[model samples]
Every structure is written in C-alpha cells, then in structure tokens.
Target: MPPVPQQHGHGMESPSIFQKSEMGAMMGGGVGLTIGFIFGSWSIIRHGAGPRGFMATLSQYMLSSAATFSFFLAIGSVIRSDSPLALRMEAMQLQLSASNPILRSKAESAQIVRARWAEERSRASN
Candidate 1:
C-alpha cells in the first residue's frame, strides 16, 4: 500500500463524551461571561452604586453566572450528543478498565448475582 500523505492522516475520529462536554462547557462559559458582564454593567448603571464594593459584587455575579452556564451546558451537550450511551462510554472510558482490579471485581460480583438470579428463577419454575 502506498504511504498516505501526512495531511491525510487516518480518518478514524473517535467521538468522546468528555472531550465534547469540555468543549461545550468552555463555549458556554465564554458566552455566559459576556452575557453576565453586559447584564451586570447594565444593572450597576441603573442602580447607581459604589465603585469598590459594588464592582466586587458584580464580578462575583459574573463568575457565578459563568460557572452555572458551564455546568448546565456540559450536561446538555452530553445528553444531546449523537453517540449512543454505549458508544459514548467506549470512547471516554480508559481502555485499562477491563484489566483494572476494581472493575474486574465488580464484574465478577455481577456474574455471581446473575447466576443466583438464574437459579432462583429455575427453582420457582420447578
């Protein structure tokens, strides 16, 4: 096979929930900061307040607004992403989870529970 050009790198783009959500949060925070600044400024202009204490309060409000927007946008983006839940998990989760001792133990416990449930069902039937 002929070596593909450097620009035409492998086209397999794995969609990851964490990456998508982080991107969404950053975008949302930027928007929220702009909005909060405008609103906060307008509010101060209307109310007519002190420069020192009032400005401090206004800055706090802007930061809070940015945080709130970031949080909700992150969750909303995750929910609205095109990928199915299973695929989303596959992309974001560490590949080592399968070999991780904690995960393996949890999986084993689930199997034991399934076996017990199957036995119960069989006994009830008989």
Candidate 2:
C-alpha cells in the first residue's frame, strides 16, 4: 500500500479513537480510585475503626471506586464509537443555540463558527 500522506500544521498526530477511549477510561479510573481512597481513609480515621473494620471499609470503598471507573470506561467507549468529536460538538452547539435566544441572535455563519470552534478546540486539547 502507498504511504498515507501526513497532514501538517497540527503539532502532533491525534490518538486513534480507541486510544482516546482507553485513555479516558484510565484517567477516570485513576481519579475515582484516588477520591475513594481519600474518603475511605478519612472515614476510617474519623470513626476509629479497628484493623479488621478498616480492612472491610477499605475493601468496600475500593469496590465502589472500581464500579464508578468501569461505568465511565463504558461511557467513554460508547461515545468514542458512536460519533466523531466534531459532530458531537456541533450537535451540542446547535442545541445550545436553539435553547438560548441570546446565543442564537449572536451566532455567526455555520462555516465560520465551526472553523473557529475547531481551532479553539484543538488549541485547548493540546
């Protein structure tokens, strides 16, 4: 097969959809676990749990965190598979403009709005 032409201007290549989804899941899980651990530790310390009780409480918190992480992972995977990011943002903008008269009144042409939105989104993501 011929080599795929690389696009210039974008500073770095974007991750594949699957990679993005996996990263999202990993990040979500890490955050969930961190939060759960902090809360669990606080609760155990505040309640003055015995060693056995501490272990039980810790286990419960870990399980709950795992569930929350898994939920986010599933959502991330579904979102990545279902639509491209640009399309999703366009839909969101449309909904926002429709619901807000002030925003609608100030809206630019679709082409200009989309170009600016894409540029800003890329900058922010980077």
Query: What's model 2's lDDT at 67?
Result: 68
List clashing residue pairs in candidate 2.
none
What does the lDDT come to for candidate 2? 0.72
TM-score of each: 0.54, 0.45
User: Model 1 reaches what TM-score against the true structure?
Assistant: 0.54
lDDT of 2 by residue, 1-126 (tens): 466854434764555666657767777777778878888888888886666788888767866886698678857775755334677787778777856543443456676789988998999999
Show the lowest summed lDDT stretch of 10 residues, model 2.
98-107
- Candidate 2 residue-wise lDDT at 113: 89
Write model 1 residue lDDT over 1-126, tens digit each, in one string.
Answer: 466633223674545789879988998899888888888888878885566667786887688889999999999988877655676677557554676423447788899899999998999999
**Which prediction has the highest TM-score against the true structure?**
1
